[model samples]
Target: MSAMTTTPRTVTVRTSAAGFVGGIWHFARREFRDAIASKWFILYTIAFTVLAVGVSFLSLSGVGSHGFAGFGRTAAGLLNLIMLVVPLMALTAGAGSIAGERERGTLLYLLAQPVSRTQLLLGKYLGLAAALVCSLCIGFGVSAVVLAWRADGVGTGSFAMLMSFTAMLALSMLSLGMLISVISRRTGVATGVGLFTWLTLVFVSDLGLMASSIIFKLRVQEIFGLAALNPLQSFKMAVIVNMNASLDVLGPVGAYASQTLGGALPWLLASSLLAWTLAPLGLAMLLFGRRSSV
Candidate 1:
């Protein structure tokens, strides 16, 4: 008789992994790694920076011989451009996350694992948002200097409001992209559809509002009502209200007021932002559960 020696493998659960901590970390890590690896990130960033800087310089040059020039105007314009660009970038990061995996035949592998689809989406969503934060932080940080220079005694409250709205917009962008990802079988289709949707939501809504004004020839409140329904436009109107309180082109408080204790305009806009952030994410989760890529 021969004695057989065997070593048993012991299984151990990760003691540190608990609650949503692991999920959040994993999600953030995946997004940032992929973002850095993606060539589009670099190319778009460089193009945006060059254009923004060029515009800023042009605005600054317009002032008399460099004594605190018209730089603020340029800075605001650049900030607006950055705002527009960030959402698209966020959409690209998310819109194909799952669909690409499905197209590549890897999504099945993930589904077979013990992890839930919700976990997968959360991880990717967090990761994409984290990667995006870097660009936003840098871009906004630079623009803040310009904003401060042109403060003209405007309250710092508007700045705070703007930042809050910006963060929500970022979240909404990610959620919308995630939803689109599961809506298609192919990543290419998902991306195309997502971008088209973003354009429709962002630009088309404003056009519709313009059309309404012409069609109804309505007064201020009616025009405002039309703008309120569009999430992107609502956010824009809120930002403009807060960012340019000193200017009269908008209204008594820019375009609308913040904190709904007074009325609905500002808060309604904020609610729209929140809705965009949550609604798409919830819908994406539902779609992902039923999605099977083979």
Candidate 2:
């Protein structure tokens, strides 16, 4: 009774779901700032701009008697170019995100913060997506403006479709790159894997298809099924059909896809691309959650 007793005060700190979401946004903003400041982003933007403008100019200028003209041709050229470059750039950007952070010794400190793995991965993705989309818009937007001005508003619909396709394609590639980044222990390994993935998906896949058709003598339906598995192939087919380009060059698979899917081709391809964009990122998040940040 003579002794004075003091009880310790207990405080509980709970993070709301909304607070977690807010943290994600905060991290995303930081990532976006860092990405835009990168020299690689600047160079990519410039290269895209120059290539887009040059292709559009050559198509619309009528310099040669047999020179291609109109927005359709220009859009097609840009699609081909985008298919090659956007994927590469996106892979490079995404492949390094986590691995690079780890290499720089910043990832551990970031993990020490009151942030969940899901939030961090999603935040990084959003930031990278924004940066890539901005680069695409600037590059493609300039080309569109020039075409509308000089080409008398040709292929506006086709141009819009092309932009949509390119954006989706970029997202898909970025997701793949992020997956690679999450799996690799080092940035160099992530980058090598990313490049190999791009090369295999973009170029080797077509060769494999050709070989398969020769060896297996695949029917139209079988060929279409196989081609649809590749995101790049799906993108090309969707754009070609959307622009009403020649199907003769697409061969049997193209003809089958064009006729069989018909009005549904675009929707199917869009859905496939959406799957491509989500599946890898989802898997990476799961893996990242399980792996130790230390």
Candidate 3:
């Protein structure tokens, strides 16, 4: 008689409570490196630098000709440019993020890893944010240096506030683009949606407010509330208020918001922008979590 013995099979599995953070960092690093390497990033940086320099010089020579030099004048002059440009850049970059990954067939591979969807989403957002913020800082920093040299000196406080507001605007747009990316099945669709969103929020929204007021006889408070729904409007108001610019420039809505919201308008607008940055991301996380990698 022969006795046969079966060896027990051993399986090893690794788990960590803090592994999510590590996963996020790993993906974030990868995304950041990839973003910086893209030709689009290079072109974007150059364009931003050139435009910023041109605007600064024009302000110095033209607007500063009136003895308006320093951060306030420079920032106020650059506000329209930054508001127009930063959102477009952010939307373009973010619109292609997840959708492009899926289109390229890399998303499945990414999902094959042990990382959770939330971690991956957060990592991607943070990575893109870092790249965008870097470009913004470099472009604006160069202008700031020029302003310092040409003008009496830049207003440190106003410059900082402008940068902060610009960063928030970029973040808000990025979050919106990510939401679109998650919802879209193709990169092309995502890009189209992103552009449309930018146009609606930036241009059409204001027109819509005007039309609504004219047609419906909406009050200043109502218009202001509606405008606040658009992140871009909130951003502009925040910048204007923070710069201590005249509220009359904003017209009735401005007057109403200033009186009703009072000094809290800036804080409220900032909080609104923060919410704009976060809410879409949270929604995207939920959607991506529910979706299958296949």
Candidate 4:
């Protein structure tokens, strides 16, 4: 009798756990299949691979003629390309996710399913994230193999670090894009807003900050603090400090900030990126829940 009672309890607990996970996975799998078949996925994978391989080749071209080149220069080149391309890819992918569903009249059907709003939203995000990871692995993995074969003195550690930061940046942008999607009721508006946000972060923020610093004669700490608020800036600073051999490439302001902060720069920048990733997603969830309840 005791064994039968214990078995029932065990079965109940297992069922509960499975139910909780099963709901999320159902939508996740569906969205993943859709994303895999999307045209954007194909373009992203091809573009990223081509850019990565091209950057590696150009960086290593000096090996035969002038002097030795390695992953250091390749990483720097790739960083610029990634800072431009990955954000656009992630932002567009995220921006279209929810709004596109709503536009197609599928979001209502999705909401009426057994899953809660939280599970549905979370599942979609994870599905998109998984697709992004798949693209990154294919793109970066191919480049890494090629570089290892062709380049001399390839710093695998630095390359890996760059890849890590790239993923973080992608996640950050994706969260922001989701927030925009939630706020905008239409897919067209969401796409436009996403592009505007990307432009502001990639170009306007850096230019405006640099101009302000120059005009105001901002101190090193002031510049760093302001720049840290922008994910792109933080990512650039973090990559420069961690990957590059010297701080000179970051210019005077960055070098001074590095000198002033010492070992704390990486942690600060990482914290900023983490905040960028989480805060937007939380806000989006809150807004989404409220709208759905209404």
Leading candidate by lDDT: 2
**Residue pair clashes in candidate 4:** none
For candidate 4, give the lDDT of residue 270. Answer: 83
Weakest lDDT window of 10 consecutive positions for candidate 2 = 60-69
Give the clashing residue pairs of candidate 3, or none.
none
TM-score of each: 0.78, 0.91, 0.92, 0.89
- What's model 3's TM-score? 0.92
- Compared with the true structure, what per-residue lDDT tens digits does model 2 show for residues 104-153? 98888998888888889999999999999999999989998888777777
Give the alpha carbon lDDT tens digit for every residue of 1-294 in model 4. Answer: 354544433332333767867887988898889998999999998999999989878877856522124777777788899889989988988899889988888889888866677777777888888888888878888878777777734576777788888888988899999889888878999999999999999999989998999899988778878888999988988898887533557777778877777788788888899999899989988899989432
RMSD list, candidates in order: 5.0, 5.3, 5.0, 5.9
- Which number leads on TM-score? 3
TM-score of 4: 0.89
Q: List model 3 lDDT by residue over 96-174, tens digit each.
A: 9999999999888888887778888889999999999999999989997888787857777778888899999999899
Task: Give Cα-based local distance difference scores for all models.
Answer: 0.67, 0.85, 0.85, 0.83
Candidates 1 and 4: which is better by TM-score? 4
Clashing residue pairs found in predicted model 2: none
lDDT of 1 by residue, 198-254 (tens): 788777876877787789786766666666666676667667555553224555333
Please give the distance, in angstroms, between residue 153's alpha carbon in candidate 2 and its true position after superposition. 1.5
In candidate 4, how many clashes are counted? 0
Ranking by TM-score: 3, 2, 4, 1
The order of the candidates by lDDT, greatest first, is 2, 3, 4, 1
Could you tell which candidate, 3 or 4, scores higher by TM-score? 3
